[model samples]
Target: MTETTPYDADRARFTRQALARLVLCDHAVAVADGAAGLVATENDPDAGPGGRVSQAFQLIELAERALVSAVTYERERGSSWAEIGQYLGMDPAEAEERFAADLDGWNTAFDVPYRLDDTGLKRVPQLPTAAYDPVSACARLDTWAGNRLVLVNDEHPVSSGLTMAAPKP
Candidate 1:
């Protein structure tokens, strides 16, 4: 008789989320480059190969980060090397070695803690979004500008000056 292990809900969910994030990362670069019309051409030596090389590098970096994080999460959750290896389609030792450099790089770059502190769990960081209230933004702009109004995206240059004033009696 064959014994089947139940599907891991957490692993499945995390894998889905990681893939989504990777897609979003690539999409974001494409969108921004498209909007700016910053396509690299053969004529321009500075912007080589339609920015494809750079975009590919970015994608690779993002993928590495996600893979390392997921592996770390699995390890923290008490997943055995054999299980991780099976999921990665490799030998147990090879699986660990494959992710070693990426995991080390991630550890060096980010100071984020894997475990909870004495008080409680750490908060998840928020991703950037386009959502904003213009009213509040304008109010903040007014406060920042004060008496000297700075026109945004206008011909007139936005300037700031520091003036010394005598102490009031």
Candidate 2:
């Protein structure tokens, strides 16, 4: 049998919940940045109301994506459909049915990590950029979390003890 390297082990341990959380974190960062931009433009004499409204609309879209990711994360963490449905004010079956496709896609991504580009020269990852590159995701997420959480101060604060080294080619 072949020896299992640290990277392989880490990758194996990176469950669907972890991937969903990474996606959520990425979306959260984008939403935060977009909100900041909207605030900055609020008082800018050169910024138009129409542009600010457009930016706000984009932020709303991002927030919706983040909500989806949050649901995915919760499902992966053993949350019951009823529990999730309660928050959305819908039946459990309806809630599950609504998110079924997204859940299926998330599961399928692991089986088919990437696809060829039109030229067949470049491979495009099926998972979100952060989830696809878990090593970088861990680092970036840890930094972001550490900066936000007062109790955390070290490198890998969020992903501490996780083996997130890049795989050997």
lDDT of 2 at 156: 73
> What would the per-residue lDDT of candidate 1 be over residues 86-145, giving only the tens digit for each residue?
988999999989877755644432333133346666432212110012222223333444
lDDT of all predictions, in order shown?
0.43, 0.76
Report the backbone clash tally of model 1: 0
lDDT of 2 at 56: 85
**Against the true structure, whose lDDT is highest?**
2
Question: Which regions of candidate 1 are displaced past 4 Å?
Answer: 1-48, 100-169
* Model 1: lDDT of residue 164: 19
Q: All candidates: CA RMSD in angstroms? A: 20.0, 5.2
The sequence of per-residue lDDT tens digits that candidate 2 reaches over residues 23-125 is 8888888888788787664477676658777888999999988888888988987899999999999999999999999888888777776667999987666
